[model samples]
Target: MGVRWILAAGLWLAGCATSPPPSGLPDSLDVSSRHELTEVPFFPQRDYQCGPASLAMTLAWSGLKVTPEDLKPQVYSAKREGSLPPDMIAAARRRGRIAYPVTSTADLLREVAAGHPVIVLQRLESFWQTQWHYAVVIGYDLERREIVLHSGAEERLAMALDAFEQTWKPWGYWGLVTMDPRRLPASAEPKKYVKAVLGLERTQRWQEAEQAYSSALARWPHHLTAWIGLGNSRYALGNLAGAEQAFRSAVRAKPDSGIPYNNLAHVLMEMNRTEEALAVIRQAIRLGGPQISVYKKTLAEIQRRRNS
Candidate 1:
């Protein structure tokens, strides 16, 4: 199975249009009938390296100077004869990029129109054979009813929209848009965006996580997790004041959530505001949620500090 085999496999399926346009797409997506991210770089895959190649294109477009070769060790799986989707996601996260999944065709187009190239997995052959292939979708012409891709050995492969869906849908319409943490995908939902940022935070990329958290708050003001993550990241970077401000914002966002109060108490204690810390922890303990035990611990720690 190579590029030729993959292309040949899809030829019979290209002309028979089947999948319908997805419903409930945002009005913002209708702003264009034709759109393309021409600046998105292309890397022709070599053998079972389409995953790395496709990821490289999107990562580079996100302003990172990377190559398929550099990504192979991180994303490729010789045992599986290709890269796993989770591995691809982790690779992007490790590089300080958000690997946001664009599962619907409409959202994929939305991201492309917003100048983001998407990495999509396709089952090139019949469902039985399952010739799984990775490709980058960089453009689409809704007027002409075509999808543009930077496929293997073909920098500009144009397939019919329905044809692309036939190949993509079997894979659960699975696609991903790699982007800077500072930027959110055009079709980002608040919960998904915050989850992606949380994944980035696990990578210990505090700076990028901070940018993403800040961006999340900009879009969805006073999102509780976004504020808490922003505070945590700021604290990691030695910006106690900024962290305190973020925690304060979080406290305002969800006054009943003990999580924010517990975090805010910690930040206040770090700033040597022991009295304020005690007050915050007491509120958290009083209005406790899931972390009641953690709040109790925080109160004890604050008391210990005051006594010393």
Candidate 2:
């Protein structure tokens, strides 16, 4: 992130991806041609602190009071030259918010329209000197064909959408936003949120995972993965009853899914409901079609518990 003195001014694009942008913006965005999230706060990047600065601003806007100085150790990599996207996303999850990728311009715009600012990676250099930098997109003007960003020392930096897309292309147009788990991305599928939260839990952040899943359930009541995730988190936290309820909800949400049956059976065995456990284990064995070994292990475990 040697982006301190690298003024991205007058940088002409030598190469831009030929892929087209998103088809259409969301209808809810009252795009009378121009829009700006004036209330979105900003923090200018100090040297290679763009990653931290951008995250601090976006997270603060999402309901956290964090400064870039506070986030350096968590996101900045002195050895790697800069912070990676995964690290930034992980840091957001560690801070108890869902940090999911933005796939398209429409997605970025939708976030702005929904009052969320997006952190985007861009090439702030000429084609000959590619400087990878992080910036926060705060607004856009479709009629003027431009987007606004909080980049470097400049707040409210504006660039033609074409130039923005070009600069973003080198980085695969990568961007992300932090938001309440109860809120879903406007231009994305509900499943994306599940993956992001589950990814956090996979990193061993169970409390955050539990909250994320709860939010998912509140927003999309039938999100089977969320119920399963909530149950797993509860189980890990030693809440057998809560885990049992979540697993039961999963079964009700998606009766065909084999995972809930196996998990529910295990929880019942843990609660010393051996007879009920045995009943569910059989159902798990039958429904857990592909992951035969999983339910088989659960069956053996339950039998061993009863014998003990």
In terms of TM-score, the best-performing candidate is 1
149-184 per-residue lDDT for model 1 (tens digits): 998778889998887888888757888998898788
TM-score of every candidate relative to the true structure: 0.89, 0.85
lDDT of 1 at 83: 75
Clashing residue pairs found in predicted model 1: none
Candidate lDDT (C-alpha), each: 0.82, 0.77
Deviation in angstroms for 53 in model 1?
0.3
Q: lDDT of candidate 1 vs native?
A: 0.82
**Number of backbone clashes in candidate 2:** 0
Tell me the TM-score of model 2.
0.85
- Tell me how many clashing residue pairs each candidate has: 0, 0
Off by over 4 Å in 1: 1-29, 126-129
